[model samples]
Structure formats: structure tokens, C-alpha cells
Target: MGREFIEIFEEWALDYDKSVMGEHPQYVDVFANYDAILNQVVQQSLGTVLEFGVGTGNLSNKLLNAGHNVIGIEPSEAMRNIASRKLPSMTILDGDFINYPYISVQIETIASTYAFHHLSDIEKEIAIKKFASVLPRKGRIVFGDTMFKTEADKQLEIEKALDKGFTDLADDLNREYYPTLDIMKNAFEKHHFDVSFKQMNDFVWVITADKK
Candidate 1:
């Protein structure tokens, strides 16, 4: 199922950058805040970092400029190809989170922005376990994505998005699994992660966890 979704994303890769990258008006500021949060998490200079779901190399470029050795794992070949072209110096892998190649490497930090919510609950749990298994002790995992405040809040947001042409009804239908922050925190905690969360905006939040 995940593989199928990746294939679809790969097929859409040509237009993905134009469609997704920096399309939102607040994207730059949002990412800037995320960079600040990430800077706080690393504390010192960073070592090797793995960016799961490095879509279009947008955040990848930022991480590279921050002096981190970054390996970006992206499921879509189209997206990977785009990232490779943009970030020729960095390593880009066309692989899924559940089956990436470099299991032996002890990653110091892992980051996924706006991508983790695509996973199902079961797959997310598996991926979290895998992340914990490969990370060094005290390694950090930073993830950011949208979270609904309540079922009513979600419905209202979807309605507003449709009315404002912010998103299509089809897109809203596909996004049936955007979990709340509390749910995400519990999931991470179950995998022995000491988690902290901050609401970044009306629709988005960031979660940073350290392997316990």
C-alpha cells in the first residue's frame, strides 16, 4: 500500500515542486521557525542526519547549509531525482522508511517535515521503532505536520479550505488520517521516546523526541 502511494507521488514528481514547494504564503516563515526549533534540538554542531521524506530538497538545502552531513531518503524516484539535481553533493535514496538500506549507520538526528502524517498508524509505529533502533542513544527525532484540534475543528478546517479554494475536496478526502498532537505524543512515548510538542500554527505542530 505504501509502495503504491510512492509510485503515485513519483508519477506526480514533475509538478510536485511547483504544486507543493513554497506554494503556501506562510511556508518560508513556517520553515524558518522550524529551523530555529531544530537548531535548539541539536544544541551543538550536528553530525550525520537522516531526513526521511525529503521532498523536493527544500528543507534538504537548508539542513546542508547548516553544516550537517545529510542523507535524504525519499520514496518517490521522481522526487529523489529532483532532489539529486538540486542537491548534487548530498546523498538521496529512493527507498521507503520501513526498508531503507543503511541500517548499520547510527544517525544522530532524524527529521521529517509534513511527511510523517502520510503513514498509517501501524506503519507509523513500525517506522518509529525502526528510527529508535538505528538512532544513537540520546539521538533526536524532529517531525512537523498538521494536527486537528478536534473532530469539529477538522471538519471546519476542511470546509474552510474548500470554500477558500485552499484545497480540493478530493485532497481533504485523502487526508483522513491527520492525527492530533496528543495521539502522536502517545505513539512516540510507546516506543520509548521522550517527546515534546509545540503548536506551530493554526493547523500545524512540531514534535521533537529523544530516544530513551
Candidate 2:
């Protein structure tokens, strides 16, 4: 399933940026706050940064322009190639964030956007713990992605989708375990990171976890 998603990104690479930024009504409502959310993430970040799932280098480009050294990890060759062209001097690793061998000494902060939802619920918890393992004290993990407050919150969204005749989307949301803000906070705290949540909009949020 993961490979299948990566393949989809490979095919979508050419138009990925425009597709994401375009004013599609279904997405525009949530994505409208995209830059503002990222701006908050950048404000919290410090020193050298590692970005997982750095698609097309949008956030990375912003971070670089903000004068931060950024290393990126992207799974799709096509996506990585585009990001490389956009950020010619920065190192963009070709690998999966869940399996990537992250070096604590090298990374000062880790950030991701609109990508972490690809993980299963169990995988998300494990990944956060793994991130905590490598993060130096005071290092932060900031990510903005589609998230909910609880299963009830997700169900409400699903109901709205169904009302709007997006049956397929509703079904997909049912199958995907998008984490709640509280769930993620507990996961980070379990791994000894102080965590906070900022809802960027209705469906997407930014989570910051600082290693203790």
C-alpha cells in the first residue's frame, strides 16, 4: 500500500506543486492556511533542519530562503529530483522516513508537512518515539498535516463528506487512522517530549514536540 502511494506521487510529480496549491474547492478551504501554518513552524525551528517527505521542496525552499540549512528525505525519485533542482545545494536523501537511519548528531530539528498521514496509527506512534530517540535535548519535531481531535471528530467530517456526495473520500477516511491532537500529544509525551498542538484550520494542524 505504501509503495502504491509512492508510485502515485511518482506519476503526480510533474504537476504536484500546482495541484496542491490550486484552488480546488474541496481542498482550498483547508489548504488556504498552508503558508501561515508553515510560517509558524519556521518560527519555532532552529539550526540545521531535517524535513521528512519534503515533496517538491515547498517548505524546504521556504526554510532555505529563511536562512536555515535543510536536509530533506523523500521517497519518490521523481519528487526528490524536483526538490533537488529547487534546492540544488541542500542534501535530499532518497529513503523512507520510518526506516531511514537518522543521526542525532546531525539533525537539530525535524519538520514535515501534509505527509505524516500516510502512516498507520501504530506506525505513527513508533515513528514519533524513534524521532525522540535521535533528537538532542531541546530539538523539536514540527509537522503540519491532516489531523483530528478524536474518532468522533473524524466521524463528523465523514458525515459531512457523505452529505456532499464524496462517498469514496468518506470510505478512505474511515480506513485511514488519522491521529487526534490528544493522541499525538500523548505519544510525544510518552517518549519524553513536551508537545503542543495548533490547529491551522479545520482539518489540518501543526504539532510541535520538543525533546526533553
Cα lDDT tens digits for candidate 1, 57-115 = 87778778778888888988788888899999888886776878764566888887767
Q: Write the per-residue lDDT of candidate 2 for residues 1-212, one digit (tens) a residue.
A: 13437877898799877756754445554576788878888887888898899889989988998889888888999999999998899888876657765554567888998888888767888888788777789999999888898889899988988888877557757765678887788888889999888888888888888999
Q: What TM-score number comes out for model 1?
A: 0.82
Off by over 4 Å in 2: 1-4, 101-105
TM per candidate: 0.82, 0.91
Error of 1 at 2 (Å): 3.7
